[model samples]
Target: MRVKPLYFFTILLLFSSLNNAYAFCGFYVAKASSDLFNQSSQVVMVRDGSRNIVTMSSDFKGNVNEFAMVMPVPTVLKREQIHVTDNKIIEHLDSYSAPRLVEYFDENPCSPPVMYKMMPMAAPAMKSDSATVKKRARSLGVTIEAQYTVGEYDIMLLSAQQSGGLLTWLTEQGYKLPQGADAVVGSYLKQKMKFFVAKVNLKKFNQSGYTRLRPIQIAYDYSRFMLPIRLGTVNSQGQQELFIYALSRQGRIETTNYRTVKLPSEIEIPSYIKTQNKFADFYRDMFRTQVKKQNNKAVFLEYAWDMNWCDPCAADPLSNKELRELGVFWVNEASNKPQISQRRRPPQQGQNVYLSRLHVRYDRHNFPEDLLFQNTANRENFQGRYIIRHAWKGTEQCNAANQYFKSLTKRQNQRAKNLSNLTGWNINDIQKTMQIPQRSASSSNEDMWWKDLWSQ
Candidate 1:
């Protein structure tokens, strides 16, 4: 959907029931949608040295005739430099990087199972105007450098000498900008950036026989590695969600302007989070809580790993052909090697590509500046992973079992606290939901130490 005032960048279930009980291994119950937050957008950027390839996709629900896109770029894109890619790749990338809910059943304190099984379940256009708009555009120093029809989109490369003129020209031409958008546009104009504007070609769109818009991909060789998000914030739709997936030949990509903190992962949470189908709720609350904790100034790193493989994989790595489509020109297209599959080991070396997923909840106040990014040599693997350790269900009792039962209560209590801490939920409510009892001098028969040992 549109993440900005106008339509802007908007941008999967696997069943492998039984899996080896190992680190990062468990059944993925549910995943939270980026749509969980309002005004959300997704962008996939692939970088190698000075070459940058950016793909923009959105779920614009407006009339196809009204769909349009306006973005800033360091250089003008040529016909060859611009392309349209399948939207499925973006979805695959999202699934590969999304935060996951994993559940691990507790082995009986007395006897552990050798194996286990887990089941899995699953842009609008611009306005129109005539020659009078073009004359005004020229007087306003807004020049349309080039125009082409790429796929179902009618694209234009525009260079403007001033922001007010450009904004006026755009307005006359039917592209509406937010009240203060001229300031942001001026900033980009001062940087010698060009505006890449697009609208749907109704005839081409119909002839293409597609249901919706495919992501637009653009490649350019420029030294500035950054994203201009200020325009998106000018409209001020409260806070917006931006998920950026960066693919690089070197290593992890991180925001240089804002603190890039890894989201809390590998933490234990209450079991009911899965049983009650509240994984989405838990994730959304926890994310908001984390944003608050950071004063909403930090960019959260949700996933960072070699693109060649993933452990406790959310989804398979993009195939070579798919990677090429994303503008990873360095990959050997002729290689016959098999595409990376779901695996339980550390990422295999030699893919020469690493992916870093950065999430931000931003508004004009906390994030005044557009995102500035840098690629790092740090290839350490990371993912937003939460755990659910099911309590051992058994009747037989032994010395180990007795201790296990005692520790289990403490563990469950700690889980409740964790949920509270991560999500900002009330501790009492969390405990009540998890059935954690308060410690007291007067206890019920069920609380006695000998109760389970002596009884069947």
Candidate 2:
């Protein structure tokens, strides 16, 4: 009886050693996809039949997890498992409505940050055992990044971007207020503030049909690229508070209620625009700081926004003469709300209706070109003489958008090289190359077209 009990204990110990050496048994990788939100790349995981959990997401636990066929890549499997592998790549569980679970496609995926989740169950023991070596292995930091860029847009929406930018314009013009001081104050403060909303509307759609692709659309795409957002606010005490949100593949999740307050300021608009002293510039600067310092391990950068802090901007105390010329955007004045034609609407509804002139009217010649150009004017102005801020609405469309870390892919770069093969894009005529989408509609326009040789 004593010998039998000892023999049983000895056999169990041997089995346990063998099991530790080999790893997980029976449980398989149920499903895997890339586009799913909240994804991980450092490790794979699965669940056991009796509701026990297993994981592949790990740095060595002083034991080899991969050897146990844990979340093994399809390439490592035998022919019998090929069909299962194909199913994983092609199908998913509860993926349709779950944005986090969809396998996002990217020629280049973001270097998502390392994520660690503890599994509650252990692997079963094996009968055979083998011994090898032991040593110290350095733990590595892992990051994952996924980007959803349907349309192309730049990655940063900074002070260098337009003042009539979505945040600016929306706060300025998008709302209707109750008739009183609270509403007035809200309207006044909103215009100077900034923040990235989860949903963005291409508000200019009705205004620009053939004139150009609406800039709000570009801004929308730009936001999705995990572009940084800056918000400026002011408190009643004339204190400035800037909220900056960083873009990650995950949505902007900040620990503070920094986004909802007002920050007071004593700053001038034109002078402020001239300098990078605007509140939004704070987060914009932080964004440059973060992206410039992104580690090599590509992490999923899903949705990131940034903000800037500020006191309510100082009030303009200019006389009527100065307001008329340098600042025609008179607060005492009203903005004209032009009516739209059916051409602006989509093909489906009310397309047959004739357009109406906007009920509002104002003197175009008296327009504040200076105010509009205070932040928007540039040497890189593409449209004939007029930029987007002020002018007869342009007929030429401007569509500049992008996705992922940067816009230029190896394939895109190759296509760029092959570009000369397909068309007469003369490399020698440096001043006259067209960057598709809005290519030269006329001979003279060719000389004015601009294309950046680089994108991120």
Query: What TM-score, computed on C-alpha atoms, does each candidate reach?
Result: 0.84, 0.12
Model 1 vs. true fold: TM:
0.84
Instruction: Report the number of the highest-lDDT candidate.
Output: 1
Worst 10 residues of 2 by lDDT: 5-14
Candidate 1, lDDT over the whole model: 0.71
Give the alpha carbon lDDT tens digit for every residue of 6-87 in model 2. 0000000001111111111111111122111111111111111111111111111111111111111101122221111111
Model 1 per-residue lDDT tens digits across residues 133-249:
567778889988888999999888788999988888777666656667778678768867778788789999999998978888887666566776676666655887777788988
Clashes of each: 13, 75
* RMSD value for candidate 2: 31.6
- The Cα local distance difference test for each model comes to 0.71, 0.17
